[model samples]
Target: MVAKKREWRSGRRSVATKLVQMTRHLVVCEGTETEPRYFGGMKDALGPANGRKIAVVVRGSGRHTLDLFEHAEELCRIAPDPYNHVWLIFDKDDFPSNEFDLVERKCGEVSSSSCTFHALYSNPCFEIWPLLHLRYTTAPMDASSCQKGLVDALKREFNVEYRKNMDGLFSLVDSRRQDAISNVDKLDKHHKSIGNDRPSTMNPSTRVGDIFEELGPYLDKGD
Candidate 1:
């Protein structure tokens, strides 16, 4: 990941200096390689804090489904400074429906005044997110199909092959972020229209855009 330098500044030097509190975020991902690499790229893109107003920490636990959510909760509890927001990222790849649904439910129950928890899940697989940057579809896909779609889309759009742990993956798709977010909204509406509310049953669906929406201000603009 390429690092960028950023400067923090207050409006102006005044007789009375104002203190700015940094907003902290903790993102725990289930996949130890792919998810971590993508978010690590995000952190690098946001650049060095340099005592900035936002601080983001990304971690990957080699756990699945509910276990990943529990790990996130535990990490939040032990952090020196309580996180303002905690996001758990996981995929619904062959996980039992009950186990998948429980994590989303648990996120709602564990939120408090100090910290808010959000479940950012991808049905089938996380590859759906990158694929959305290239095209939009409402077709249901399993893990294999989702990855195949990503491979085709990457080759078609970027002339590159998709790899699970590809370095700088975030930068590769950063330019079409708005397109992905728009597709996510459409997919969400499609699921709702069909009366599909459960994450496990919502094939071809992903809430990954929720994290992007929350961290929009801190993200680097793409050309």
Candidate 2:
């Protein structure tokens, strides 16, 4: 008599599961050290209660913001179908306000054919300063002073020496990046809670929540 074959089960979790248990890669530009700090945590923050799992990657510094478009070009040349969803974030600086059209055009030329691309711009620099300001300060804080206050908060929290004014904020985020990576390892084993609240893809409003909300339809839409 012929024997029946047994089905295989994923008793053991994989590395990607630890990241966000994602089927599609969520590519993000203007990589933030603070915002979307960890893959799992960001997933929790941006994920809806019933939404599918999402994975995130911060491409690099926005100083080379346009380079990300070229990177997308290379990606399309290779697999082409690997990334079904892509989100590009950048700061509005160096270029004039009227130059947004040009930036969007460059991104479109590379990203239009292969994946779903959404370009988000933060004035001056990252929206993190504004987000943090909104969280801590009452009135709107300038990017420069917001940077100072954030650095002070982190320094006080970590008990570290204070650094420069505007640039100090970067250090605060830099410190958190490690914590995020470490948390990834832990999340591999357990469903850990991230940030100050529960994970909800429905509401992407926090600091720079608009970007999260804007990207929501694309991230959660059925294709």
Candidate 3:
């Protein structure tokens, strides 16, 4: 006997064909303040473009990198509708190399199923990614220097002191969005030419712009 396929009905119309699918995103950040405020604004600034409502769920629970990864997994487990993508943002400020490597591996493992769990990481701090928005610099700096430069630049350009929980932070650097992405790519190339094998360890380096660009399709056109 042949098996019949079950139909999903939505008031007489097939639900699958009648409704547009939106890509749900779960983004857990290591920073409870800075990352959420920035990414939340980024999410809020988007609209349903290309028939995709890019929804980003930013979780800021003061979790570390590994814990953040686990949090994203937990979200996927608990959410009735699994997210299309799960992103764990990380800052390798003082984290050990083992932890960093382990987190990356765990994300890789979790990404094998339906959901794609991505690890978006910054070298020293998340501030470095935002600092690239202000100016292009590849100078090697530690965590403290990165934070100081970011704070100073924000104060000078926007006339606002760098606060972790500042709302609408994405708008402040929205105009230079492309520039920030360009700077990140340029910095990576610069590092490669200089014999720096580990770009992530290169101070002021980040793949945050990559995630931004992925979400940019829905962002730039609408806002």
Candidate 4:
């Protein structure tokens, strides 16, 4: 949203203007529990924004693919304040390739000067994100296979059980946040090299780290 025009009485008008320029982000996820819980923990960990420069809101839609994209659009449409960025987070899963790819295409169509929509997807499932923290693998996997991989990785690496709705899941793997981001980038390049540019065809890959990359500078350091 554009800042209101103001007549400043104090010498700190520039500082006040900076506060009004705060960027707001809306993250809409497909899963009702797991995705929301993981991202919610990240929001908490980010704490308060410095000088109110950034604000993040995370919501779970209990929807998938194109439906999740529509839900995100509606949320932004009805939001009291306009969001500077809207992120649609979902899984490639077994959704038809055409439908899976449509969301990313629609993101471009719906974007404008005021807000930009991004389709950040995980191939197979969201569990791939957590699994990346422990180790990186380019092997293609389906939903069940990805979940099994995560379970094995968690048990082997941290001696912890992987639960679908586990609390503090973010904190459990926060230490390796950078590693996960790096691995995701590597996986992305691997897919590109193999001519697998479509989101639906990029197995065992995720763009979830893109959100973290954008928000890294605004994260609260006190935590």
Which candidate gets the maximum TM-score versus the true structure? Answer: 1
- The CA lDDT of each predicted structure is 0.86, 0.44, 0.78, 0.86
Please give the ranking of all candidate structures by lDDT, highest first, separated by commas. 4, 1, 3, 2
Segments of candidate 4 deviating more than 4 angstroms: 1-20, 220-223
* TM-score of model 1 vs. true structure: 0.89
Window of ten residues with lowest summed lDDT in model 4: 10-19
lDDT of 1 by residue, 69-139 (tens): 88987898789888988988999998899999898889899888878899899999899988898899999
Q: What would the per-residue lDDT of candidate 4 be over residues 102-204, giving only the tens digit for each residue?
A: 9989999999998999998889899999999989999998999899999999999889998898888898998898899889989989999999988888998
Question: If scored against the real structure, what TM-score would every candidate get?
Answer: 0.89, 0.44, 0.84, 0.88
Task: Please list all clashing residue pairs in model 4, or write none if there are none.
Answer: none
lDDT of 3 at 55: 63
How big is the positional error of residue 73 in model 4, measured in Å on the Cα after superposition?
Answer: 1.2
Q: Give the Cα-based TM-score of candidate 4 against the true structure.
A: 0.88
Residue pairs with colliding backbones in model 3 are none
Count of steric clashes across candidates, in order? 0, 5, 0, 0
Quote the positional error of residue 56 for candidate 4 in Å: 1.5
